[model samples]
Target: FLPLRGILPDMICDSKSYIDLLTIYQEKARKDCELVGNYLYDLLQKYCSKNVSSKAQLDDLVSIYCKNSSFLNVVRTSELKQEYRHENNESLKQYVEQLPAAQQAPSDGDQSESMMTPQPIFAQDCPELCWYIGLRLCDLFHEKYGRYPGEQLKDIQNGSEDDNSREEMDTDQRQIETDLHDLKLIGKQFLTDHELAKHQGGIRDTVLEELCRYGSCEIHSIAAFVGGCCAQEIIKLITHQYIPIDNTFIYNGIKQSTALFKF
Candidate 1:
């Protein structure tokens, strides 16, 4: 889902000066984001002193950093009390004009191919555990199969299929579309595989057809549900009121099932 793994370094390399600033705050918070942010603000102070002359420009710089920084996803919502206005929680996209102009992505080709600024991981970095593994697999598929999940579905489903299709999509919708496209294709591959016979209930054609029906779906019900749940947990931790769940929540709307497990 995140292009961070295996490709993030190249993205961040688009901003080596800012990337070097990260070295000043690595592994420095319990969440490990606070220290990095402090370091970022310090470097920002120096940069702003020399280059940024206006609050608007400074906001733009900070906003772009918020959108690209690895720590951004961890901090923006939970730490910022965003209350789910956006998922991917890009509370900062409004501020980013482009990846900090301190360094720009190498302009070797068209903007489409150069959209991503890949930042590589470091030795001390903690591994990220995302639930959307299928999406990650699709990224891998792009390397071997020579197509992104979105491109795969694009072959079959016209993205602008709906009347509102021409509508502008925000960053979060774009992110979700990319992931959903991957999920649909990966699910299709899994369904066709004879080895994965244990799982059932997916009528392959019907499932894929349904997915295509909403080819450009940007549904956010799940975002609100998940966001509210997370906000509740954060409040509990801050107010020291009701106890939070121990861990793991498994929700399956299609099966109408829910399970909670604590290890």
Candidate 2:
């Protein structure tokens, strides 16, 4: 049977930056696990259509999976061995600092390495994809501002004691406009850095506006639906009976539909 693994991260300090970095790392690590599961299932379907094969055949499939899906494409050369340690503490520090300085260049390294950087594929027609892209932008906003968009407005309004003065309203509007403009700037910089600026159209303003208004608040209805879905997916994985999501799963509560994105 294929092995299943769970994350047990290394010891981390109690600082907020480190905590935020851990969250991002965990999200990326979870995505990596899903990618491996999907790749393995596809490989099995391709090789063993009817039933499990001989030990030699299974061994070959494992080797092929390793060669194709190993992190960073490290298996491109059989002689290349991956070393994991705390040798890159400086790089980690830069990464944590990058949240506040979105335009900063990545720390120096071997620029010629074969690394996978998924370019932004913004499609105006796909709301799910656009929403996903907006979520990434929201994450960047959090990194830079240490608060989600609209959060400051919420706090200001809360502290106003229902006065609803013109000055307060104008301040809220100005804050929102500033946040939206900054998000757009960061998104553009991200696209340029990833060489995706030449794409036909960038993210739409409406998407950014919606995300700004959201302020990353958790809604109970959406949370309940997502939680149920997660439970079902976990059951599927444990039972090994039905196919789980391939890679990306998007749920649009507005549209009341779910979409699968395989990349």
Model 1 misplacement above 4 A: 1-197, 200-212, 250-263
- Candidate 2 per-residue C-alpha lDDT over 29-93 given as tens digits, one digit per residue, 9 for 90 to 100: 55555566566667667897687454445555554443434232211221111111123233223
Tens digit of per-residue lDDT, candidate 1, span 1-263: 21121112333444677566455433232223333445556676787767635544445554444445544322122432332123432322322211222222244455442112222212121111111223334455466557543342322223546544434333324643555565666655543442332332222222232233343344587556667778998997799555565544544334434444322
Clashing residue pairs, candidate 2?
A: none
* CA lDDT for candidate 2: 0.58
Each model's TM-score? 0.26, 0.49
User: Which structure among the candidates has the greatest TM-score?
Assistant: 2
